[model samples]
Target: MNYNREDELKFRFNQFIISKVTGENKDYYSKLTIEDFVDIKNTLSNINNIITYKTTISFMDWLRDHFSYVDENYEVYLKDVLKVKPSVNGYDIMVTGKVNIVAEIKCNKPINNGFKYGSAQKNGIIKDIQGLLEGKTKVNFNPIHAYKFLVMYDFGEHSLKATEHLIKNIPSGYRGKVEIYNDKTQLKIDKVYVVFIK
Candidate 1:
């Protein structure tokens, strides 16, 4: 059967629990009900959520710490790691990589109010790009690279249209590219790669 990442993780977690329980009480395995498995799945989901949230938070801190020092070219000691800093009120994860390519990384899941062409998402991204261009937003480090928007989500038709709207609205000079990524794509965290050019 086909399994997503979450499903695989839950299955492995359940197997581990089952093995431990069977070791302690062999009869317990036979006594387990569907409800018990459901509970285990829910618990694993919650744990995964917590871990993902923490890891996201830690990534920003890690970027800051790792790129704290730079040589004359402002490149991080780790050649592939991009320089990052906080952005405006709504935008987050500003990264500057090789050749002064500056990008705003926006991450969203596929469900619920994921990144779309909604007013909030559109305006927020526009504002961030405008702010960066106008030098209104305060950044820890300045990037001499081109501007870009790095969107991490499973794009739908609406999302594609929204991205197009965003790209069209940006000022001519700062309009660089919009990179899209989903579960199927292999994202390399070590280096900043441009996926599309505006």
Candidate 2:
């Protein structure tokens, strides 16, 4: 899709206004006149590029903070570390316990840019599921069962539809099941989670 810088700025500005007007500092910003708000929004739009980077970083930080507690009630292993092996790619976070779960966290800027459903991204997820089904992916801990998950920062309908298409198009020989967890409020971020289980 073509990128419109002005439209992007306006969207970011609206997000900023919503956040501030509904946040702890709402009293201060909400009291400002519409003209003052527009002025502030314009000033912010001028530095939207720089603020964009900051917003991305902040989103990632928020993800880390929330996902860190995924296994709060369980005895988690490899909580904050990445596990790598010579055979398969590394995982961002591995939660090993009664129900072993390997998670790959992905942060995409703007959240609205959506995910690309090309071979690279689609095959990457497929390959991970394939590896898990074939016992090619390795983890430090052992459990009776395990699952693979791709946790990405995306809420756009296009991205979600693309993921659904990817799941439906998986080769028939694949034995595992792919499921999406769309209501993981614990994460507290706009995210789409795809899971594969054997």
Top candidate (TM-score)? 2
Ten residues in sequence with the least summed lDDT for candidate 1: 189-198
In candidate 2, what are the lDDT values of residues 81-101, reduced to their tens digit? 323332345555455533355
Candidate 1 per-residue lDDT, tens place, 1-198, comes to: 775886675566557656765544233434558898788678776653354334434444444443443233333323333322222342234444442334444432223545345666566556555544443444554432433334333245545555656566655665543334333644343223222211
TM-score of each: 0.37, 0.45
* Alpha carbon lDDT of each predicted model: 0.44, 0.50
Off by over 4 Å in 2: 1-79, 82-88, 106-116, 137-144, 182-198
In model 1, which runs have C-alpha deviations exceeding 4 angstroms?
1-98, 108-116, 140-147, 168-198
Candidate 2 at 98: error in angstroms? 4.2
Candidate 2 pairs with clashing backbones:
none
lDDT of 1 at 149: 31
Whose lDDT is greatest here?
Answer: 2
Model 1 Cα shift for residue 174 (angstroms): 7.4
- Model 2 weakest lDDT span, ten residues long: 189-198
